[model samples]
Target: MTAPTLFSPLKFGAFELPHRVVMAPMTRSRTAQPGNVPTALMANYYAQRASAGLIISEATQISPQGQGYSFTPGIHSAEQVAGWQGVTRAVHAAGGRIVLQLWHVGRMSHPVFQQGHAPVAPSAIAPNAKVWIVGEDGLGGMVECPVPRALTLPEIQAIVDDYRRAAERAAAAGFDGVEIHAANGYLIDSFLRSGSNRRTDIYGGSIEKRLRFFYEVVDAVIGVVGPDRVGVRVSPHITQRGMDCPDMVATTLLAARRLSEKGVAYLHFAEADWEDAPLVPEAFRRDVRHAFGGAIGVAGGYTLDRAQAVIQGGWADWVAFGRPFIANPDLPERLRQQVPLATPDTSTLFGGDARGYTDYPRTA
Candidate 1:
């Protein structure tokens, strides 16, 4: 079977993309520290890769309490929203579309980012993950995540309101769309899995209750941006974040069906990419396709060949690249031309200046 080229045009909601390659949201932690706001340099960085069919911005914290690391941009502040305006304008000026990834780290956080307050989650349980925090000397390193304070019912409702406000802020920042970052064991992901959500309230317990928080959030955000301009990201295979609950698969599949019923733009799943990670089962893919009527996207360490295979097999509508897009601003053209690939310097992947960022030279 002949596979569609990476440069093939595709439909993402109401937008018609020039190609199907997407820039996956990656946390670079490069925003200005004092304000945790986007910079002109960051604008230049995303503009360089504006050729992608869609560019999902780095995870931006929805509120100050939602922050988990140093130097991460936020969507809750005026300065941050203005800063993102430049990013969206740059991408649009370069003839591209962009989506803001709304994030709340939940229990995957340290007190440093939370202003001495413990991170909040659906339950008081911990994820046993290390979060990056700046020490007294201003050097960033991983610190143990503490057991979070369980959010009260009212607090949970307020958080959903925060998601709505963040979506409105994203629109005010001139973004074409918004993506709910419910993946990778964040706040929403914590609520979806039994491993973390052992609560007895309406927000936990049965699978239906576990997904209540997610549904409320989706409904709130959709009210602001409309379902056509909205998307949700989910990861059903990540165990590193202590999210491997017994019902993880069933829960995420149900989440997909519910999102589809709501008529959102698309569903994106972050496949496990570890060296020996288990592949996403074909059965899961078939069920996901049948359960969701909209387009589906897959993101991970996908190469040209594997990406082509997935598209050819009709399993995914687009392939989002992470590390590759870090160094290859013109990734779509690079795949189209079959040229030499550039490697990303792991050292500068996190918080840093433009040294390992916009400085990466693009191929003509």
Candidate 2:
């Protein structure tokens, strides 16, 4: 039997991908201001990288209350939906498949983004994290997250409805699918972890309860987009932003099994990519594989060799490249041809214009 390489074709849900190189969602913070809507430049940026098997868009807030960072796009408003239509049209024109990543930051948000109201979470705990906010001078910097107020029971139900509406808007915006952003210590991630979710209600306590909010949101999204057009991203080993959950791996596995039962299109693991971050254990990967019969994708600091190895090992069906995709728009081709990858400018990463976002020279 031959080993599957990174260049292997993959049939992920309704999309027949030409290769296994997926473009991970990255927040460039270059959206059109005032409404935080997707721009034509953003559409160009995505079209430039259209060769990837799949492109999971940057985390787009589901509502005004879901926003945590400055200039990040949203999916709630009619104008926002129309803006994203241009983006989708551009990507489709370039022969690419793209999905919008639905997001809610939960307690990882600052009051500025919340219109002076405290951010909402499963519990009233601060994430001890910082969100990037651009100051009046247009200089973006990290600001500490304050202790948030807990969401009321009614509010929790409302949030579930928010997920459903967001999925509907995503479909209207012409997205091929929607990837629920339940990772990176965001809203859904907070509820899925025991350490963060101290709620004693049906939404917290035991592992099953801790997974309630996540399941509700996922179910709501699936109801709108159907299971085949839904994908979920989870991070079991990431302990940053006060997400130091002891049972995260177990919780993630449980979620995977249920999502598999729901027949989701795929499960994407957003592995911690820091130099000192804990490695996602192969044992856990095996557990997820056993639990999830659908396509599996992983994103971290994966190079071509590592991606090939993981795919060949049967732990993952595809690989998502983040930072590498920023600098090399034709990253899949570069990896295929074994060319050197370009480095992205860190200074221009967050709130910049085209210099770092779309001006990267392609060597094809």
Candidate 3:
């Protein structure tokens, strides 16, 4: 039995993976209502796709203050922790490892989600992006983001404490590890890119200062679960939601090195997934590989051949599949057997029932 194309084994920290396929973090907005919590439906959803080497759960808000979207799960409350316990057990029962992606949307949030206060961030800049929120009509609508109030030093300490607490909750919920969601113009990503962060305090103005929030967050999380069980996801080339900046690549690479020094288990790069998205330059990947001596995971519109080329040549240790995994529960097996992938139902992608969430059929 020769090794399968992209089905090679990989060592992601303490765990040994049977294959190098990852289920990238994606927000499906199917969590239970009233208080954002995971459900049995989510447990079934993740268990069906347990073939992946690792499963990074949807972006989960750390605290009430971290929330920015409707129907997204949180890890702060007791109910939320109990809710995720089911999901983690289901994945583990199916013989898979899973991680929760901790998220805190900064300026991307509307005042509605921020409890009538301006969303907080490293600086008082507007993202000029919109976020999904349920309005007076009881329907989800995109609302313009408000200019976030800059976080004071004490507030910054509080947010870091929130991340640490969230990590503790994830461990209590039985997660294999935790991934910091610092990409796609969220709080950490905003602090890293100069376009979004315009502060003159110790938290901004220079590359090192701009990265202070992220470093502190990572340090806090590491204090909770150790560095080997933590991963950081970053988006260097994404042009989405006013996050693109001239200094994006340089800052991301520098942040990657700092994460490596923190002894992070892996660096997950969220490559551009849109049509006509900018390609991740070879030079950037080469630099990242040399600078970060840990596992590298890449995701964004990748096919089997592209994944094979990267992993086979040592450019990345694994490849994460996002949308494809939504419709194909047995994605890794299908890819290993060269089966055609099922098309995703984008209509039911968010804020829906199990129709497009857990109703996908398992392949033979």
* Backbone clashes in model 3: 0
Better of 1 and 2 by lDDT: 2
Deviation (Å) of 177 in candidate 3: 0.3
Question: Model 2, poorest ten-residue lDDT window?
Answer: 7-16
Q: Per-residue lDDT of 1-364 in model 3, one digit per residue for the tens?
A: 5433478788867657899889998889988878998999999999999889999999999988888888899999999999999999999999999999999987788778877999987778788788888766767878888888988889889999999999999999999999999998999999888878888888888888888889999999999999999999988888677777787778888888888888999999898877888788789889999889789999999999999988876789889999999999999999988889999998888787899988889796
Highest TM-score against the true fold, candidate:
2
lDDT of each: 0.90, 0.93, 0.89
Work out the TM-score per prediction: 0.98, 0.99, 0.96
Task: Tell me the spans in candidate 3 whose CA falls farther than 4 Å from its real position.
Answer: 1-5
Estimate the TM-score for candidate 2.
Answer: 0.99
- Give one digit per residue, the lDDT tens place, for model 2 in 177-214: 99999999999999988888999999989999989989
Pairs clashing within candidate 2: none
- What's the lDDT for candidate 3? 0.89
Clashing pairs in 3: none
> Over the stretch 214-237, how does candidate 1's per-residue lDDT look in tens digits?
999999999999998998899988
